[model samples]
Target: MHSIATPKLTASMLALALLLAGCATSPDFGETLETRSEQASAIAGDYKKGEKLIEAGRKDVREGRKLARKGENRVNRGEDRIREGEAMMAAARAAYCRDTGYATPECR
Candidate 1:
């Protein structure tokens, strides 16, 4: 074999085989960085969406407070109206009893 081939050619063939075996797989360093950046961007987007939803919930709570205040005012007004009607009915009943000198139809 040494008669036909030189040592230099044997060395060159070994180097080529080694290079080809080492490079069989595609380069992954650039692809790994790109995939990590995409994951980071997605995480950032999710964080922003969560913040916006929290803001919307805060706005809804403020609106609910406003509605509760309005409801309380309406209830207070209704209570005052009921008190006035009860006082008027009592006065009318008293007047009827005084004139009849006994239990009146209104008292019954």
Candidate 2:
């Protein structure tokens, strides 16, 4: 009777130890799921910020191109005015030389 009792008591103790060990090592499912959800939210926020920056950059480029075209048109108009002024000066010099019967240094 003593030998039979010892074997049964030993088996019961072994089973209890295994149950405690399993509880100690088990993962907390709720905390793991929450952590993953927060990480995904952060990634989505970063993507939105990047998209906004890209759109702003595109808008800046468009405005810069418009300003450059305006500047080029202004320069062309100034050049045309300069050419007209030179032709008027030449005509005035030629008329002065023809009427005075003397060539000035500038007219020559």
TM-score per prediction, in order, is 0.61, 0.56
Please give me the total number of clashing residue pairs in predicted model 2.
0
In candidate 1, position 17 carries an lDDT of 46
> What pairs collide in candidate 1?
none
User: For residue 62, what is the lDDT in candidate 2?
Assistant: 99
Kindly list the per-residue Cα lDDT of model 2 for residues 1-102, writing each as its tens digit: 468545643333544544454445546635453454454455555655776898999999999999999999999999999999999988898888888776
Q: Which pairs clash in the backbone of model 2?
A: none
| CA error at residue 87 for candidate 1, angstroms | 0.8
Per residue, candidate 1 scores C-alpha lDDT tens digits across 9-52 of: 33335444444443454365454544545544555566667768
**Model 2 per-residue lDDT at 53:** 91
Whole-model alpha-carbon lDDT for candidate 2: 0.68
lDDT of 1 at 80: 100
